[model samples]
Target: MQTPEQVAAAFDLLADQHDAMRWDLALSEFDASVLASLEGIATANVASSALFLAGGSGREALSFVMHGWKCDLVELSRRMLELAECRLHKFDLRIVESEAARYLADTTEKYDFISMVGELVGYVQEPRSILRAAALRLRPDGLIAVTWVDSSSLAATRQTEEQGVVALVERDDLEIRAWTCETMQKYVDAARLTVVLRSGRMAESPRRFWILRKEM
Candidate 1:
């Protein structure tokens, strides 16, 4: 298995190589389900007419929204936020480069559509807290599209032995938890949210996508 440090280093390498890193390759290597969700997001347009992208990197998603849904992207990385700004200069995109956790907690801003791709759920220190808080801010009938790695997979377990740019290392150094589908669904129900879509996909880590709507 590759070391966790090696996984991080690989992303840094991608950042150096492509102006925008290709996570689709990583997802194809882990779980196939990721592609389906991406395709879905690309096609679906929210009724609230407002979409929010969490942990957005570069601007692939925001580009979609700018051209399709007319929404904003909020992220945690300063580097990513800036790069997105540069890429999305022509569009009316909003980028908030603050800790996603803090933003979720402090945000009074309500969104009709919330998208969190690329295991954004696991990236936060408290995935449940962030999800629940975000759920509350939604207008009833608002949608939360969240994806995370299923802990059963080799990549999720950090047991992957694959070579050539796959994340093999367990990021134990990052104080975050890996979640399975059931665990995430538990959090969704606990947040008093309703599940509208439930399915798994094959991506970099056997990713799972959930489409949730806040219950009135």
Candidate 2:
């Protein structure tokens, strides 16, 4: 796993190309799905505040802000946050440049919704600790949404051995960690969050998304 500094540097280097690469990978579809899931939950539960972890370029944050939701976006990459600032100028959003674990540890404000998307959960070395921190900062009836790449899948297994770490745009090292669905579930369960909604398309890749709620 890459340290926070290394990960931030990698993302900073890729900041300019992030949106184009995402579009090329058709990840915007998955992002839309996540936004839809969040929207549904927010409508049903009347969510007002949200905390978005590792929010790259703040696309999801833009959606939340547009919908009249107060958002706090935490990203490790300063360049990414710069882009986000440009995109989310007139919204109720707070942009923080810090690692997710550190930010969660330092914040005492509870949120009605929390999200760690773009497979950011897989990049964490101690995912369980992060989840626990998120759980602690969540309201009793709040929701947490996360996504992970299934490392046990054939595609990920092949990539793990071949391109574990590579240079994106020949600028910085991009480290990819192998995190299976079971591994993610174990962490979520350990954090005492119950899975309420799960969806993913495994035909081409092992990327999956899940929405969890605090156990009552």
Candidate 3:
């Protein structure tokens, strides 16, 4: 469980290498697939507005912006937002440099969709609180997408010796908590959000994504 400041510092330090490192991990493809699935749901639901939590470098939200969806991205790292600004200059994208939970707490605006992509929820110390706040900002039929690493996988087993915290970029001093899919599911269920879609595999790396909707 990392604090907002700690999470921000870690990401700020990695901002420059973030894109390259993520690309190496095949995260871009995974994100694209997630976006494609979300797009289908959005189209079916006639959703036009979105709130993206921990939207790093704004890649995942770029298509939504191009599709004329009103998009607001909440990211903790100023450097990441700077990069996003550079790439998304033509669009009126609202980029907020704040912790996702805090930003959601302060906003009264609701959206047709909200996404916490790339396992961002895993880094939070209190994911349930974030989910609760997100639920408040979600429209009645809107969807919330969350992704995380599954704890029951071989990857999680290997990380157990390190207590689920991994050092960033091989820097032994800085580490972030690695959350499990079960733990994330608990939080989402506690927030009273229903799981509408589930995807991903649990073998070695074990990444999982879920699409949730607030119960009427």
Which has the greatest TM-score?
A: 2
Backbone clashes per model, in order?
12, 0, 0
In terms of TM-score, which candidate is stronger, 2 or 3?
A: 2
Candidate 1 positional error at 115, Å: 1.3
TM-scores of all predicted structures: 0.71, 0.85, 0.82
Q: lDDT per residue, candidate 2, 1-216, as tens digits?
A: 468999888888888799555334555566667767866765665548999899888876666787788899999999998888877878889999889999999998899889888877667767678989999999887889888766655343223332332111223376555566666778888999999888877465566889899965
Model 1 TM-score? 0.71
Which of 1 and 2 is ahead in lDDT?
Answer: 2
Q: Which portions of model 1 miss their true places by more than 4 Å?
A: 1-19, 23-53, 58-60, 67-70, 155-176
Question: Which sections of candidate 2 miss by over 4 Å?
Answer: 20-28, 155-172
For all candidates in order, the CA lDDT equals 0.58, 0.76, 0.73
Which tens-of-lDDT digit does each residue in 1-216 have in candidate 3? 346787777778788788555434565555556768866764565538899899888877766787788899999888888888877879868988888878888888989888888777667666568888899898887888888765554343124233434322224324434555566667787888999888876333456779999876
Q: Indicate the residue-level lDDT of 1 in model 3.
A: 39
